[model samples]
Structure formats: structure tokens, C-alpha cells
Target: MRVRVATTILGITAALLAVPACSTDTAPPARTEKPAEAARQAAPLSSATLETRLLDESDLGEGYLRKPERPSQHNDVTVIGCPSLSELGGDAATGGTLSFPRNAKADFTYGGSSSEVSEELYSDNAAKLSHGIDRIFDATTSCPTYQVLAGGTPIDMASQELPAPRGLGDEQWSQLLTFSTGDRSTVVKQTAIRDGSLLLIVSGSPALVDRHLDKALAKATTTS
Candidate 1:
């Protein structure tokens, strides 16, 4: 179900091209304490190196295929606002349509007819990345149910906050969203983790996403 949810969401990537990247608003300040000295010492992943380490179809298990037509990189941060359950990384970055400063980003998707996985990398400081997570937690908590129009159709959606997974990053958040229209339904499991200056988001089947996240963080840790 989460894979199907991610697939539906990835289908709307083209729609994001129309959203203007003009928002100058930054995320609201977080109430948490500053990062520890050790956290600050961790290295950031460069765009080039991140691309090399990103998960491809091979890493997504057998029979999972990638789209050759998809762009290798996406620079416009504002396009994260599109309404799709699998767009968890985008939703986290923009704080549910609230834009924030992001210096660089890269995303890739692998899918089959019934399942999909989406991974997104965002480059920013620990504070900014943490703030973005806070915003998403706040939004999901305050308003569990909401609607966003995608391609002029109202999509009914609901979110449920889950306990944060440990040992993934400096800070992490997880949630589940169910999207419905008439009888069709899709459920997505999303996880956002802040590893030093990089923010990694993976959405789809929880098990697959979790597995890939561990691999990603491990590669990120070794990035020079």
C-alpha cells in the first residue's frame, strides 16, 4: 500500500514544474537546543558525491525499474509543494507548502506496477534541517486531516504521527498518510532524518525505505 502510495505521488512530479520558486520565507525557529560540537563536526555530503551514493534501481531489489527520462537533479526547492502522499521529503522541506532555503537537492525513484520507492536529499545546516522537521511535525499534529488540490482535483488526506526511529540520524521523524478518493486508497510511510548538514527523506514501503536509509546514511558518513 505504501509503495502504491509512493507511485501515485511520484506521478505528479511533472506538475511541480509549474510552481514558482519565489518564496523567500524561512522556517520558523525551533525551540530545541543547538547541535552538539560532535554533530557540527560531521561532514556534509556534496551534490556530486550524493549522486554517486544515491540508491538506484539495482538497490531497490529485483524487478524494480528506474525511469531513464527522469532528470538527474532538481534545483527548484519550491516544487516540493505538490500534493502527493509519497512527496514526504518535499512536504517536509516546504513544511506542507511553506518554503524554506535549500542550497541543493537530488532525488530518484524506482518502481514497478504495484510498488515504488522515492528518495530525496537536501543540503542545509543542521538547524535549518531540524526546523523543517519541526514544521512538518507541527503541521501533522495540529491538522491530521487536510486537503490539497492536485491537477485541479481535491485529494482527501490524513496523517498520523509515529514514534521517531532511533539511530538513523541526529534527529528523525516518521509518519503515515492515507489518501482517498471514492473507493481508491493508498497509504504511505514516510521517514525524515537529519544527518549533519544533509536531510534524507524516503517514502514507500516501510521495510524497503528503512533498509535503503541505512545504506544511504552509511554512504553519507563516508563521503569526503
Candidate 2:
């Protein structure tokens, strides 16, 4: 049961897209006049290829693209959901999904999410994807329990259960997180997979967002 939904961003600030390299000061030794060695060194290992493409309104999958009435500078965001695949992009056979965005040279902004739950408990297995906007959530947040998997391998699960005196209702679990990271404030909703797990991803610049990690926990009373 995989379903997709869309969200809006008031004003978006594209995060830093460049991945941080290791902080190493060691330099390579000077090359000798060896013809064979010089030729091998000159040969490129990897080609200068484009990495990402921006998703525009016209470029999104049918019925998956949406634009707010009041348009803004960072208004281009296309989201998709597939339970069997990462929301980002990679191949299914080799765990990868591809997105042919608008242009090759453009710095694209995107997020990834996936979740699984027991059919007996949850109505639909749903996932959410949002772009062009950061999550908005309060400083004090409550995350729901979710299953975790690494490369299709079952890892663990995560939960948010309080003492009997203070417990949240099921409806509250669907509420979004109100938080501000750097120049953006974001709110992300939690989707529980009755006896399954979910993955919410975030990527961009520090000025926009930071770590994109999955929160997992194991429950004491497992669902059938």
C-alpha cells in the first residue's frame, strides 16, 4: 500500500548542494618523466558528468506536480513516492532510481522518504515527498516509532511512547514537526507502518538543512 502526497513551502532557500570532502592536507608526490606513468595519470578515471537536475512544474510526473498561487523564487519542487524505491533516485535492480530533471547543469534540491506498516492496522501504506521548502517544526518535537532498513536489510525500529500519564493520540502522530534549521523552518509529518517502518530524508546546504538521517526503534510489544 504505497500512496504519495505533496506539500508547499512559503519561501524556499536552496541548501548547499556540494558534498563535503575529507579534510586531508597531504598532497600527491611530484610525477616523474615516465611516459607510461604520465599517460596513465592524464587519463581520466571518471568523466566530467552532470550530477543532478532541477524538477520544474512541466518536468514532473503527471498529477505529481503542484504550484502555490503566489509563486516565489525557489518554487520548483517535485515529489514522488514508491514503497519499493528510495524517493531520491536509484536503480531498482541495484537499488538506484533516476530522475531526468529539467537541465543537467542546474543544482537540484530534493528529499527522500519510505515507510511500511501492517495492513491489519493502517489503512494505506503512504509516503510523503516535499521540495522547494524545508520542514517546519517546533523546538520540542515528538517522533513516532518507525522501522529501519539499510540497503534492504532489516536494521531496527524507533518509537515515541510516553508513560501512561502523558500519551499522544493517533491523530497527533500525523501532525508535522515544527523546527527551524539555519535559514529555513520546516514541519514534517510522521507516517507509521503498523508493524513496519518509514524513512524520511533531507538534503541540501547547511544554510538550508544539515543531517539527513533515519530514526529507528524496536517496540516492546510487536504487532502481528
TM-score of each: 0.65, 0.17
Worst 10 residues of 1 by lDDT: 1-10
Give per-residue CA lDDT, model 2, range 1-224, as digits (tens). 22121222211122221222111121321211222222221111111121111233234223322222233232222221223212322222121111112102222233221211110111112211111101221101122322222223321222222111112111111222223333443333232211111112222222222121111111111222
How many backbone clashes does every candidate have?
0, 27
Ten residues in sequence with the least summed lDDT for candidate 2: 115-124
Supply the TM-score for candidate 1: 0.65
lDDT of each: 0.52, 0.21
Among these predictions, the greatest lDDT belongs to: 1
